[model samples]
Target: MSMSGDPVLERVRAIEDDFADAMSRMYTVGNELATLRARLETEASPAQWTPVAEPAAPPTPAAATAAPQPSPVPTAPAGLVTPPPPAHAPAYAPAAVPPPARPLPPAEPWWQRDGVVAKILAVVGATITLIGVAFLLALAIQMGFFGPVARVTSGALLAMGLVGAAALVRRREAGTVGALGLAATGIATAYLDVLAVTRIYDWVPLAGGMVIAGLIALGGVLLARAWDSQLLAVVAVLGVALMAPFVGLDHARLTGAFLLVLTIATWPAQVGRRWWALELARVVPTGLFLAALALAQERTAVPVVLALGLAVLVVGTTVAGTRSERLPLQLGALVPVGVMPVWSAGVAAPDRWVGTALLVVATCLLLLAAGLVVHREGTAPQHRVPEIALAAAGVTSLTAAPRAVDGGSLAIVAIVGVALVWAVAALVLRQRSVLLVAWGLGVIALLGSLALLPYVVLRSQAGDVGPRHLVTAVLLVALLVVTARASDRIIPATAPVLSRALLALAVVSTGGAVVVSGVLLGQLLDDPRGGFTAGQAGATVVWMAAAALLLLRGLRGSTIAVPAGLTLAAASVVKLLLFDLAFLGGLARVVSFIVAGLLLLGMGAGYAQALERSRREGTDRTPPGPPPGPVDNPTAPTPIPPTV
Candidate 1:
């Protein structure tokens, strides 16, 4: 803000700074190119010039014939071949030079040449034959024929392989063969390494075996570096990984050691290694992480706390890597960091793992929201991921809560809490689309909690239609109505149509509940007949009176009251025609008619009085003008005011 605290101008200044820097960079590049071009011109090599030789006259026929029958000089190697005659003597000496030794047959590269298939077959055949021979030698050693010399034989083979590799490299033609020899030597040495580790395992401890394996891996790295071959390095490390478990440690130790080895190997790739290693190493950390997590799960005392600490470390490390420009490592670190907490929670509380996982996810999503709002790069993407995650997490937590928690009421409360959180976040975040959804889900949750509390959670007191039931019903109904009634406040002003829709919903919801409950209560208290009766007709009158009351409220400026009242009147009419006439006795029928008639009369009188009042107040009054018949007279009058 440059001490002025004006963020908009600060943003503009940053953009301008970037633009200026870009232009300056471009200008600098242009100057460098121009300077390089000038220098190149100054230092360019001189063009060679040769005196143009006059076209030599074609040799005369007699001289051509006379040219000592260029006897096919017996073909000789280049050094022995006759030299061409000097240009000055060429006319006479043309026949003295053997035609330039037939252009050496264009040397054919073996790969494209006809023999390539044969070479491949030979390499394959030799590899198979060697395998067979090695098998037989091993069998011989097993039979005790060469038991004393087995190690010596293997050592000799490795030494011979090294010598051959060296010879191939020195000749600079090793290409594929040297790579094979180096790999084969590593393989041969690997067995000896295993045997040596086996000896160490017998005497020292597990660490000794690990050291032996590490040494073998170290050899691979050294050889790969020396020979400049990634394949060998990969082979070397993979061999150690495959062999480590066979050293006879317990399953736990084996898994741990293996993960440790892989973790160490992952670093080279993470810190900017080349193609093959990077590709191979990319999978290493992922494998180790999963395996370690699995192992943790199996352990009775999984180090969940340690895992959390490491999760923090992972995040911090990634941040540091980004600051230091280790982008690949930074990207790699997210996987383990993300998975660790989830895995730890699962391991730490397997029975309620899902709930724990959901809680963790919800927490992370909120953190994302906070980060989105607070990060210096203020909402660049305006992403909705956190919002979406929040919703999903809420649902997951609710779904998991029932099974994990013992108290249904508490679970209900949590669901309600989550729903409210979503609704509030949507509003606070100014995500209008989320507003309606949040409200809807919140309504559902509130309804569920209210509906379930009496039946499922408080089933012992279910039969009594007491305050608990009434309160719960009221709360649920109020929530539904209020969501619709206050939608204008919840929904943005731009969505007037949606706001109106919510209002309509409120009217329907509240009005329907009022009519149904009023009817039910009337029947319950008076008739108790379980079907239509005189009370039903009474219920009809009650609805009509309720409608009249709403009309009065509407006249007092409550817009929703008008439709609600009208709807009540309609419902009452339907009930009188459909149910009351069908079931009510003669007396009930007579009373129903009288009550309905009186309600209608009162409604009419109320409407007429309201309209008359409006007229008296001049709001419904029109200005007096000469009746329509006096059009010509109106034309002769004064011009009307524009406001009119």
Candidate 2:
């Protein structure tokens, strides 16, 4: 290509050739460097040991004067005698000097490094200190050594002393175990004191006590930040959690509010630090508190409102705080947001309005996730973290849809609509995440229909169905049709198997719909037994018709359609012979068998004619060849006649 004499192309090709040569040289040099380093190490080790047969020692000053110096080379000038090599120099040829080896740091044991031991000791010491203080106070109280005021005053003094001691210790040895342990003990003691003030003595009300405890926890958080210790921050968060029960054992609302406030206070601690443990410390207690409230059969409205606020705060902070690379935190943060709808559906009374509200919540969550995906992509242009988060939120929220709705049929209808919406969105946007959500929602709808769909039509025939029943059947049928038709477009080109499965489902759903409609029509005319029999008979004809259509499609050169058509045709024959023959009677029975037989006969005849026409067309496309014979070549010489 470069030989075409284009100067610019020739120059580009020359540059590419130069680049290839340079890369080859680079690899060769790297291998040489490694070999030289290994040789240097091997030679240096032998040089350090004394030789078995040592060379003669150097001459002394007196012997050097006595010894005769070596004569210069005969070719050299008389005044220019060559200097001798050093006694220590090797006899072999000189080589290039190896680069200085980099010095490595001395290794240390794991427990001895990174203050691991200190952290362990600090955690253990804090636990022991708190437990010891509890036992001493209990013993003193049991022995009647101190009154209520004395006990409260003593606890306050002890907490203050511990805090002061922590400050002094940290001033001397900043970030040491002693300071951390003392600080954790002080914060916990302060929290316990507040709890005692609220619960044991009722000196301060629950609200005031909680406020004071929150302040102390905040102080501990500030200290942890100043000291730059994750453990201290975790301890601060856990302090408040540990004291929750004592402060509001019987007060669910107060306990929830306290935990909510604690979560808010700890939100800032997670700001540059991605402290997952600290996050879990706050989340776990709130989860447990909500669980307790639910199990107690208490009025959970207040607590639920508070939990939602906490969830919102955590989710918003997590999204706003991190980038796409930090998706685990973002996904973990979504747990509560995902659980809220389900929790609401489970705890709230079954009502249409409640169901609608929960569905709205789920929708909003999906929308929020979508917005995050767009915003993150537009701003940062990163990997598929946002899409993953979107998928997760979609799955959780969609799972809750059935539970959120009032009834199974309504739920199926709602999910089918969602599936259709996502499917169309996938068709429009062509996002893999959107396509996956569509696929997942379809499966959800199918599963929901497993039990409810059959009953839906049955109830409708019983005159118990309303608009919901008709809407469900219509939406479900529409969903199946739309998904199947657009599967190749919406599904990725790599997933041919999934695309085929959707098509199969479409066939099954369409046939079932036709048969169900027949039964429904007969039922409307006040014929149950006859309607069922006729429905089966009608189904056989419909299946045959579908098979014929598929076969026609196959004739247009579709490999998939051919097998599918054949399978459907086989299924139709089976249904006609077994089901229709066993169930139908009167004109329905006679007409079903005869119509099916005629359709099958026509299909077979059409198939044979199609093959014949295809072969005829192929034959006409090529003219008949002449009979094989030896022929004289146009360029053959007259000598060929002599040879013959």
User: Listing every candidate in turn, what is its Cα RMSD in Å to the true structure after a full C-alpha superposition?
Assistant: 24.9, 14.3
Q: What residue runs in model 2 are displaced by over 4 Å at the alpha carbon?
A: 1-113, 173-175, 287-308, 322-331, 334-351, 373-405, 408-411, 452-474, 481-494, 622-644
Q: What TM-score should be assigned to candidate 2?
A: 0.72
What's the distance in Å from true for residue 620, model 2? 3.6
Task: Give Cα-based local distance difference scores for all models.
Answer: 0.51, 0.67
How much RMSD separates candidate 2 from the native structure? 14.3
Best by lDDT: 2
Candidate 1 — number of clashing residue pairs?
0
Q: TM-score winner among the candidates?
A: 2
Return the lDDT, model 2, position 581.
Answer: 76
Residue 329 lDDT in candidate 2: 44
Off by over 4 Å in 1: 1-204, 211-254, 257-265, 273-302, 321-329, 332-338, 341-409, 430-644
Q: List clashing residue pairs in candidate 1.
A: none
Q: Residue by residue across 1-644, what tens digits does model 1's lDDT show?
A: 26558888667555554544444344344444544554454456343222222222223334333333323222222222122445322111111323445666887776787546644654464467457656876787688776544655565566457546644664665345544454545454554546443644354366666666676666666656666655556656666665665554354444444545554454454455444353344344434444465445554433343344434444444444434544333333243433344343543455565436634653454344333322223422322333343444444445544435544445554455555555566656655545555676766675664453333222132233333333334444445444443455655563456654544443434433333343345446653332234335655776787789888888877777788788878877887787667766677788887889789888989878996786687775678896766445446377777793
